[model samples]
Target chain A: DAGITQSPRHKVTETGTPVTLRCHQTENHRYMYWYRQDPGHGLRLIHYSYGVKDTDKGEVSDGYSVSRSKTEDFLLTLESATSSQTSVYFCAISAVSGSYEQYFGPGTRLTVT
Target chain B: DQQVKQNSPSLSVQEGRISILNCDYTNSMFDYFLWYKKYPAEGPTFLISISSIKDKNEDGRFTVFLNKSAKHLSLHIVPSQPGDSAVYFCAASAGDKVIFGPGTSLSVIP
Candidate 1:
């Protein structure tokens, strides 16, 4: 286990509502990423942060936003959730030296009605 | 366009047999490759990885082989057990940024 935790392990919300998922890491890794897992899509990177206040868009960055004010925490927000956004969200952290091996959190299952 | 691709959706193997998972990439700049395994309701865990500089790397029952010229890589698990059943994802990275494949579901039946 990599000292990574994702809050609200399971969440259910109505469509068009705001949703936020939190990821906390005790390892203080420099790179943190938020990904969504769907049945056929595997895990697609939604957004990532290399350092505090430094964020970048991934392949599927639309309808999603992320923020990292400190080294240990990264947050992903869906401004207006949609049925299509329902998926398992995972938070991962990676050290600079390791062979890019990411340590993942348990994951947050989000269902949008 | 997907840079990394895992064409197989699922594979089944008997216990004590060998399971081979394949991945292909279109990017030539990707110098590092890795494999991660995920069980149901759990996040992916790192399995094994190989660098572009080498053709093969092995760890215990798991091995990764990379063919830089062909732009293909494979993960081999020998004496597969039921515990090995999971979705395996292949990823490629040039630096710290990595791109993942769609993943293949592996079932090892006893």
Candidate 2:
């Protein structure tokens, strides 16, 4: 309920194809993060942005990329999807990095065939 | 190695009873811990949190206990209700970096 939204709530795409997921926030947060949730992995960060045009990789950023051109929008892209990339992706925003609670969007369930 | 861990995958508690969920972390640098609850088809929501310097933090029916010496923390809900049934995820933070543990599914039976 922190004014966050994710597009294409549920998506199913074939492996080796390109895919992009979008996260939009109205809170004007300085930090935004993208994460993937698997059965045993919990929530693994894919990437994060401190500000517009400032992006960094996360623990599980092997085959994923992210870009932020504006403060409200952060996009995660899979150049060539794989079966292993199929997971529930969540977008989060925070006023500060770790000092406060992060607000989360609904989530995007991606299934790669 | 996982810096944060939740050993239990599931828990069942009766309505009007207490529900306790546990979490452990291996990092000593972690200075803060938090708990989040999630219902099916939705993202996790912030529940409760505690600072490393404190042993306990309470808010309403929810209480979080931290044992720094043991590198353990737990969340307790009193008089649990069916609406409290959800997956709980624990997280640890060291400044700008935060790590998450695998969640524990809690079912509050009515």
Candidate 3:
């Protein structure tokens, strides 16, 4: 409902293959984040961008990379897919940096075989 | 180790009854807390939040209570409805970082 959309709502990829998920927002928020949700693990942040071209790793950034080329788009890439990486990925946008509510996209369900 | 924890994995409440969800945190630096609700196949939506300086904050049928000394927080939904069934996630923030709990699934039985 926050003008956010994620490409490839569902994806299936084999192990050791390259995969990328896209998050696009029209709200022009200053912060964007990528998270993975797994059973009993909740949501673990993979990476975040505070501003265009400025990004930082999160608690579970291992084996994942992200880039923000403009204010409207943020990308998450898996250099090489793994079975452990299969999970529901969500993208979020917030007007303020911290201590604020974030609007989330529908989410992308990625399966790695 | 998880900085945020939701000990309960599931809960059930009859329609028109009260639903309570609990959360605990280990980090003392957290200054803000929030709750989000998620339905199946959909991303989470913000429910309620409270500042560390406040003990309680209420919005309509939803209320959030924070106990800083205990590092605990809870969300209460009054007169629960079947439509309220979903997964609830509690989150804490410090500086520029925010951590989320494992989430508790609530089933409001009709």
Top of the candidates by lDDT = 3
lDDT of 1 by residue, A14-85 (tens): 999999999999998999999999887788889988899999988899999999999999999999999999
DockQ, each predicted model: 0.61, 0.75, 0.81
Better model by DockQ: candidate 2 vs candidate 3: 3
Best by DockQ: 3
Docking class of 2: medium
List, residue by residue over A14-64, the lDDT tens digit for candidate 2: 999999999999999999999999998888888989999998887899999
Best by TM-score: 3
For candidate 3, the TM-score of chain A alone relative to the native chain A: 0.98
**Tens digits of lDDT, candidate 1, B11-93:** 99999999999999999999899999999989999999898999999999999999999999999999899999999999998
How large a fraction of the reference contact set does each model reproduce? 0.47, 0.64, 0.69
DockQ comparison, 1 vs 2, better candidate = 2
lDDT of 2 by residue, B1-65 (tens): 99999999999999999999999999999999999998989998999989999999999999999
Candidate 1 colliding pairs: none
Ten-residue region with minimum lDDT total, candidate 2 chain A: A95-104
Which ranking of candidates, highest TM-score first? 3, 2, 1
Error of 3 at B21 (Å): 0.3
1 or 2, greater by TM-score = 2
* Stretches of model 2 off by over 4 angstroms after superposition: none
